[model samples]
Target: MRDRIFRRGILPIAVVAALSAVAGCSASGDTDSPKGSAAPSGSRAGRVDPRSAAALRAVEQATVRAGSARIESSTAMGGMLSLKTDGALGWSGDQVGTLRITYTGGQLAATMRALSGASMEARLLPDAYYAKVGDTFARRLNGRHWIRYGYGDLATLPGGSGAYLTDQLRTTAPLQPVRLLRACGDVRRVGEETVRGRRTTHYSGTVTPAALTGEDAAGLRKQLEQAGVATETVDIWVDDRGLLVKKAEQGELVGGRMSATAYYRDYGVQVSAARPPAADTADFKELMSTRGS
Candidate 1:
């Protein structure tokens, strides 16, 4: 198995330099935000008021609109990475990766993946992804051959993607708390700052049951951690237009640290309600069994 970190479209040196600014430590819980909130089993969404409800609804709409645009995002990761179990893995220090997404009028058409950890590049076509490590290559078959691939899940093909992130940003009804206050429950302003040159609206609140148990949130965590992972803090950042500009999570898992960050750009496209192909049901069952074993 060949697994390594990758980078694209930017200087590896510069990317590393940029990532160096981020501390090599985990962010502690901030009670002011929902990320620090804990979830209990068998819970339902709490009652939210009208004004806060409108704010959340507007935020959700803006997020969907932003996701409708093409985007390019870069991330720098550092950790004791174990690519495979039983010690085939070694440690990877501060490494950087860049992902590029091509969308035509808000529909994802292509994805380019590059990682510096192992020097790999992969291109994803609609239903399949071609991965190349130097002159060697492998093919990952995506079951969905009809619907196009989303950028969120594109660059991280077979693992996670920009498309997956976009889907999460597109929420409706009770699932969309940022859109309606009654759906959002309690809210607190977490102050504001500029991101990528855009003035943004920043608010942090406790995670409601609807927030925690929702399919999108659960799917996001489950899909990212198919191999069993632990992470801390799920943050949602909205821009001035009330759109979610970024979503980030940071945490430690398996003896190594792991993280996933996504940015929403270019909004206003109609998306299909398609889902990422499920990992093999048998494999999933076996994974659960082994975890218990």
Candidate 2:
């Protein structure tokens, strides 16, 4: 029962991490030119609507500078898994954060409960992610309660964005929505909206393969294509202080539709996460190796 449970639960959780990383990666924008084709007439220097461009730039700068935020998000990966997470993340220098992830529904959730538990605490650090499992899982793993997945190991996963996933998780997850808005080729104002009782300006755009640029841009594009996502729609709402208040991404992946919505607040909030005790933690790589053996 222990081996069966571990085999079924561990990889799906890892997929959750990869999916979260990929969702953030979708937000990388072209910082050099924020005036794609969505600019309005009389806009500054022939750029897209000067207001739109400026707003995006302002939000981007402010978010990066603030360094930390409280985040709540829900993600659905086709019919495979559904999850909700709430936590605080800091990216002032190195990525550090913690999230309480609950398996709300799906086959993955059932397996998770059978193996570990319905909820887990995901601890994020510069080099790795750690998930705290239930007592049953701990007993199976020589009494270790946490599973560590190092970014270095994720880079070797089979996929076009495998390497990019590692880089994005470590460097870009904090301000991904702003990055996506910056990279949009057709950004448009969607009027005013209220988010969590706070007024905010909404913006929407499509991120196509051509809009991406960078060393890993080509690879990411190919990965998206393979996942059946030729173009992704990204929307963001910015608050009065030029901070991202909410963001959403929708696209097709793994032969099914995938979508995620995230809310951000408490900008500049102080946050920290410490690695689990070595004696109580198990490395994911070692687990895989043992399973293979």
Candidate 3:
């Protein structure tokens, strides 16, 4: 029972983490703005509003400058899974962070609990992620408690090439919405709204292929094409101080629809996530090899 649970649960957590990481990365594009002044509203259907563009640029610069933030998110991958993550992520240099992830509701939740308890601590490093599983899981693996999943290893997983799971893990940050805004078209203001009790200005746009240009945009477009996503809708709510308060993205994937909503706060907060002790760690590749044998 424990072995079965371990096999089923650990794979799903990795899948969920990869998917979530890709979702965050897919929304971002090149941060460079086209040289020009802000255009008047309603100037052209395809033209981005000057104020909206400026707001996006400001938020992007501010977020990158802030370095780190507290992130809370809910993600649903069609009917495959639904999960919640509460954590702080730092993007000052390398993508270092930690997330307490829980399978709130899904077919995989029970299996996850059986293997890793009700929650898992994911420690993110520059080249890999480490998952701290429960004792039941540890006992099955020579008392190794942490599973190290290198990004390169993840790239070889099923459907990984198009998913950009590895690339996203290495490059994407919590402030991806601002990057999305840089390449967005049909940008429009949806008026002021309250997000998490804070007043914010809402903006929405479509991520069309034509709207995205440049080398970075071209790279993202290829990934989207490979993933069977023609277009995606992105919305963001920015606080008065030019910080991203909330963001939501919706798009269709090969299997079904995918959507995620995330809230950000406490910008500039310090976040330190240390790798697990080597003595109690197991490399995911070695575990997979053992299972295959």
Q: Which candidate achieves the best lDDT against the true structure?
A: 3
Greater lDDT among 1 and 3 belongs to: 3
Q: Per model, how many backbone clashes are there?
A: 32, 5, 0
Candidate 1, overall lDDT?
A: 0.32
Best by TM-score: 3
Clashing pairs in 3: none
lDDT of each: 0.32, 0.66, 0.67
Better of 1 and 3 by TM-score: 3
Consecutive 10-residue window with the lowest summed lDDT within model 2: 26-35
Q: Write the per-residue lDDT of candidate 3 for residues 1-293, one digit (tens) a residue.
A: 54443344345344444335323534321111122212232334467778888888888788789888888777766666667778888889988888888777666667677668887888888878888888987888789888888876654355445246555565546555556557755677778878769998987766655567543677666556655666666677789888888777666777677667777889889988898999999887676556644
Q: State the lDDT of candidate 2 residue by residue for 174-258, as single tens digits.
A: 4665565465446777788887899999887666666665455665565445444566667777899988887777655544666
Ranking by TM-score: 3, 2, 1
In model 1, which range of ten residues has the least summed lDDT? 82-91
- In candidate 2, which residue pairs get closer than 3 Å at backbone N, Cα or C atoms, i.e. clash? 27-180, 29-183, 30-183, 39-48, 39-49
**In candidate 3, where is summed lDDT lowest over 10 consecutive residues?**
29-38
lDDT of 1 by residue, 1-293 (tens): 22221222122212211121121112112222343332221232453345545666676555433434322332222332111100000012111122222112111111212222233332222333222222222222122111122323333433333333333222211123342222224454445667678776664333422343332555433433432333343345667677666544344434354443445554543222222234411121222223323
Model 2 stretches astray by more than 4 angstroms: 1-23, 26-47, 156-161, 171-174, 213-228
The true-versus-predicted C-alpha distance at residue 152 of model 2, in Å, is 0.5
